[model samples]
Target: MKITTNMHEGRRTEMYACGAWNDMIITDYLEMAVTKTPQKTALVGYRVHAGDRSAMSYSELDRRITRMAAGLAALGVEKGDVVSCQLPNWWQMSALFLACVRIGAVCNPLMPIFREHEMQYMLAHAQSKVVVVPKIFRHFDHQAMLQGLRSELPDLKHVLVIDSDDEQSFEQVLLQRAWEEEVDTARLFAERRPSADEVVQLLYTSGTTGKPKGVMHTSNTLLSNIRPFSERQGLSATDIILMPSPLAHQLGFLYGLMLPVYLGATAILQDVWEPAFAARVVAEEGCTLTLGSTPFLADLVDIARDEREQQASLKTFISAGAPIPGALVEKAASVMQGTKVISAWGMTENGAVTTTRPEDPQTTAVHSDGVALPYMQVKIVDGEGHEQPAGEEGDLLVRGASQCVGYFRQPDMYQLDNEGWFATGDIARKDATGYIRITGRSKDVVIRGGENLPIADIENTLYKHPAIQAVALVGAPDERLGERLCAYVTLHDSSATLTLKDVTDYLVEQKFTRQYLPEYLEVLAALPRTPSGKIQKFKLRDMARDIFQGQASHA
Candidate 1:
């Protein structure tokens, strides 16, 4: 692995340590804000739907956080406790996250889309004692889901519903309670804050394999990951960040929530991805920094192209989650004024591993995921784990302060074998200029426009259909979507009639979003299998490609 320029300058090491990367935690940075600029607007949560806006000054934000910390303590949320939160991009989420850290609790932020099954798995695995969720959001029955999960999860004790139009409101808890009662406990506990190495967050990856693994991250790891990128991008108090990506994801949390607050900048939150609304946010709020997935960027570009007033304030548009096609990059550059489409590559295991530098040559941004951030090291290795020469496609490995501590409770899988590097599971090539380009994932996961759709989950869901005897979910290439789900179904009886619509409709009823639903379905008398009786998904994938191509031509 080659080290990039000035990557580890301010990194800390033990008295005898030699590495460039420092070990620090989230509190280290929060204290900086309190000490330097306590009067600045640390966070601002605007509810565009309700025409309501709220601002939190740095000092006030810190105060509210302390109060929330006290409140959590009253609920019996102790240190090392897993606090699950499924809220939108609101001020409460930010305040609660900081409060959790203040009390030495691991923050488990989950997507609001997660239903009973997903919530059950995450809550059970994390052993989350407290869950904070919105009462109802956009017609989704969140309260019902919480009710269903309470019985299944014995460890779960406290259920705090945010934005509830009821007596048990988040405000009532803070306003009605005697702050003096818990203030000393919170302050005393805050004094004994966890070290940088202690896990601050247990972020679960949207697994494309078995169950999702909880990626544990410490404060030092997160700060090290963000410092270089923040400094490099010149994130400051003047900048206003517009993030459409769900805060549950790393990019959204780091950039949308943490980065802006860390830099004394304002973070504009949008509950849903509405392009017209996104453009309005940029134009109206004077948003200078925006981060999202490829599809989100595409939608923004389309909306901006349609609305002439859009993109007047956007300066940097960070694209991650999946590859940003060169054509879309060019299109965005042409459509938006003073905006650059920057591609980034990373995972839940490590935040923002690689990114295209803003000042890099146009060719660099177009061809690479940019150079490694300061303090990070990258390498390409063969199947035998030997280093590959420059420009050769191999498994991408990275080691940095930002790298995750390890999978929660899965210690055996955490350590890097002799090499002191974590396998990124991405196949990439490092050029002479230190630019890395992602080619594919080493795992059998499908990147459908940035969201990793696990094949096994879809297959398992499909198997529930009574008419379907066996199923294999595979990815077929698509220009627009990057990849579309294709399901190969073997019927229980040869005479049984099962159409593609039948499977799709059933999946819809099962609450599998439209994106996960298979675009093409093949009813096979018998699925092709290997000697081990394992259905060859690769063969089915090829068949899907041929079927899609034939259908395209016929149309």
Candidate 2:
């Protein structure tokens, strides 16, 4: 786990001394829960195989983590090693986090949607020693995919498959056998227990560049955000969290898994995002809270109205990754009578920086992404670094304990000023009371349904197509999803024509993730350009919006 650091040891010690970061790691909390509430249900995972719903109690989870950590150690995983897992919301993911903590290994969680194109670079860059994957997910053979990649990854020693019944499967190798019995337990703990300041998690996020940047987080930085956020949401030990967002993402990793462990509460995970299924789970599990994007809220509101037998105990819905449309907030209030829909704004670099409180006026969620949480600061500054007056949009900057340590293996990419403020590539305006409304992004990327699509990567791949002369990918307005990818293209030959299917097929041939293929294609004679020959993407965005609105109205 070689990675970059934003703060030196002196600065970190100073922050800790000032009480910005607590000394306890997540494992400390897990042990506390095991001692205090050993019989309480700690996790419930709705896995993809056979629609199985699995639950694990605190004591049982701790025992499995000990075994799994020993098993990993026996397989040559040492302190400061990088262990990557490309898994969905599952019991294995939770166990792996604890196991990594137990062994002082860095945990790198990859999104299940990433294929060979994305996986190869991330794993290779991180120099991951081992990787865990499902045998198959969403009809894709993950084990087979990793098998194909292993020859190229010299550092990737072990490939553990979760649901396989073979000799090398996760169940047979890590769970069934008690490896801890063979190892010196006292020596392992003495040698491997990680400190609060050590980097524990490496998560990849889309940026303006074609390659995704790996955001690094220690237990202290992550919990710094989670503690304040859970407090503001009125969460407690008795609350059960119903999480539908992918656990690999920061939103789910913090609130779904880590938050529950922090509070000694139960976490119910839904691997697939089906509105009806989620509503049913909430009713069955007595879920009191959840955090997701606008799309999940929209679907949940739609399904909750028609399902009469499902008794939803859901109290709070914290929406992030996209703006909560005002109309949707009103509609949610109408359908889901008792639930509070809160708007939150943050990125992978800093988790949950701003979120409207549950006690705030209901309409507050419609317009603001709330003020900064405790120990965090958010300010809007102009290009010249001067602070902007209230209500004026400028580059959004943040500095806090919750900010990530730095990007992994990319020291030059880490941008922080002398004052420790990291410039987030978002344009926003702050109100007099310190609420921020994100107006636009300065980064060249598109966020589709809370997942940020790699815009430069897609455009670069499309540029390789022989039939295309110029291409730009813009996000078109979507009602359910916040935006859909729209590819605007000009042909190399005026007589040649390209359709949406053609573009998608070419992208698939290039091994692009099919989920991100552009939904709309517009063939223009020439893309709008500045006099200096730069692509005028703002004009293209307006065009895409009008075209999509027009087509949607006709439909």
Q: Report the number of the highest-lDDT candidate.
A: 2
Tell me the spans in candidate 1 whose CA falls farther than 4 Å from its real position.
Answer: 1-24, 34-36, 48-51, 165-168, 174-176, 306-309, 504-515, 530-533, 543-555
Off by over 4 Å in 2: 1-4, 308-311
Q: Judge candidate 1 against the unseen true structure and give its global Cα lDDT, from 0 to 1.
A: 0.77
Q: Can you give the TM-score per candidate against the true fold? A: 0.91, 0.98
**lDDT tens per residue, model 1, 219-264:** 7677777778888887777898887788888888888877876676
The root-mean-square deviation over C-alpha atoms between each candidate and the true structure, in angstroms, is 4.6, 1.3
The all-Cα superposition gives candidate 2 an RMSD in Å to the true structure of: 1.3
Clashing pairs for predicted structure model 1, backbone only? 7-374, 7-375, 12-22, 24-219, 24-220, 25-219, 25-220, 26-219
Which pairs of residues collide in candidate 2?
A: none
Candidate 2 per-residue lDDT over residues 1-555, each given as its tens digit: 545576677668767887879788898999899999999999998864468898989999999999999999999998889999999899899889989988889999999998898899899988999999999888999999998888899999898999898865988888888898999876896689888888899999864576888899998899899888888888899999988898899999999989999999999998988877788788889899998999999998888778634535888999999888999999888888889999999999989999998889899999999999998999999989999999999999999889998998888898899888999999999999999999999988788899899999889989999999999999988877999999999999999989999999998887778878999999999999999999999999999999989989999
Clashes of 2: 0
